[model samples]
Target chain A: MTLIVWTYIVYIALSVPLTVWVAHTLHQNGRVFLIDSFHHNEQLADSVNHLLVVGFYLINIGYVALALKEGIAPADLRQVLETISRKIGVVMLVLGAMHFFNIFLFSRMRRRALLQRVPPPVPPQAHVPVATQ
Target chain B: MNHLYVLFDAQCELCVRCRNWLAKQPTFVPLSFIALQSTKAERRFPGIDALKPSEQLLVISNEGSVYRGAHAWIMCLWALQNYREYAQRLAHPILLPFARIVCELLSRNRFFLSRALFKQEAQSVARLLAAHCRPPQTLCSNSRASV
Candidate 1:
């Protein structure tokens, strides 16, 4: 393999992990993301979103550089395009599946937190004790 | 039954309030909220030393070992998530050790963080509970049949 080819391979390798990390980080801090998207806590969530996007670009740009170096096609451009299309399709499907799973997980946590949380006891004055006199 | 059982200061109005909130959750199963401060608690389960009972300890009861602290909460959080299978794995024999370590660290800090806010909160809860719960008990003739 040529030096450029090795560099390209390295790029792909680097890209995969970075992609995974960005997704994980985005997920780890996802409450903020959902809150922002829902307009509940837009500023804080968007700020984190922006930070993730920055990190995403840095890593994916590296991936594109690697993809560009693949040089001559595999004899059939259509075949190559088809293969690329298939992989992207799978990637998107996986992303969607994972997102829903996270959402499910998140909703459950919120429920538990809600369950575990006690509303402050109502003040005694709110409900008059029936006259015992 | 969940792998993580948060042994809390049930004597705390805030803690009790949180438990009440957890009790109202619409999950397939309810999270177990134990009041470690109750004398009944000592008689009911593991003994908690009085000096630090209020400090609150979250115990993750699993296959064989118990996890406390931050790791316990993390594992509990994992269980609280909908991926029940994955969460189960977290408590499995292989992963238990790692989760336990993480649970301990986090729990250690969480108590102090919520102490002040919850302290005042609990006072209000206790008063409300006193006003409501006592009346019901007092009126019920203290009879099992009546209750």
Candidate 2:
């Protein structure tokens, strides 16, 4: 009915779809990376992929809900659009940050697993006769 | 490598204590410890002294490659399941010189550290381990700080 209420409506409408779209994109594309990180364990990778998407939805949607009432009361239609734009911009940034954080976490896990195959960094000084134990 | 032989100076209480601790850790490659001049060490590597095992740590891979001092310490950690990443990080060119300095400092001052940290029966046992090894030195000959 009021401008602020209309702003909330528009913000939610924009944010929920953006969240779903980002989650779907990440879930589908991140599966390949997760599979590789998990060393080709598709079952495990899919499980993790689903879990990550669920968490991403929860955090982003919760943030959107919490941040809904943050800005000053909108006086006019122009002000309403401005508030909605600001709110959605913050949500997009948060999503981008979360995406980068997830990539960092998974890459660290993959690096640790891959370290098992890495050769010794330093070479030996000499050679000794192998003694039969 | 499948196995490693670590040669350490038995007379140093700190080294002996470290050997026992290393033996208990879970490792990717099994570790076998040998006192530098023990009968078994002499029999296994007749020219062990040429490598100067007493001055620093020595690790002999099952394939016969010998790693000395700081490199030997890194090899030991690399063989461990938990510390392999740490060893790799330490082996990075940026951190490697620091690792070498730390290892050399620890090796040179190990006896002093042992006297300060360990006064238990462990020192006596270590003394009995190698009769020919360097006699245990007094801690901080200049400083009067009580350990």
What interface RMSD does every candidate have?
19.1, 1.4
Docking class of 1: incorrect
List TM-scores for all candidates, in order.
Answer: 0.32, 0.72
At residue A69, candidate 2 shows an lDDT of 91
Across B18-101, the per-residue lDDT of candidate 1 in tens digits comes to: 556555644433356555533333333433443244443554342213334434443444444343344456656677677656
**lDDT over C-alpha atoms for residue B60 of model 1:** 31
| Model 2: number of backbone collisions | 0
> Which candidate number would show the highest DockQ if scored against the true structure?
2
Name the 10 consecutive residues with the lowest summed lDDT in model 1 chain A: A120-129
Q: Can you write out model 1's per-residue Cα lDDT over A1-133, one digit (the tens) per residue?
A: 5444444454455546645765766556775535634446666655655664565555555444544444544445455555455444444455455556556655654454443442211111111111111
Instruction: List the candidate 2 regions with Cα displacement exceeding 4 Å.
Output: A70-73, A129-133, B9-11, B16-52, B80-105, B116-147
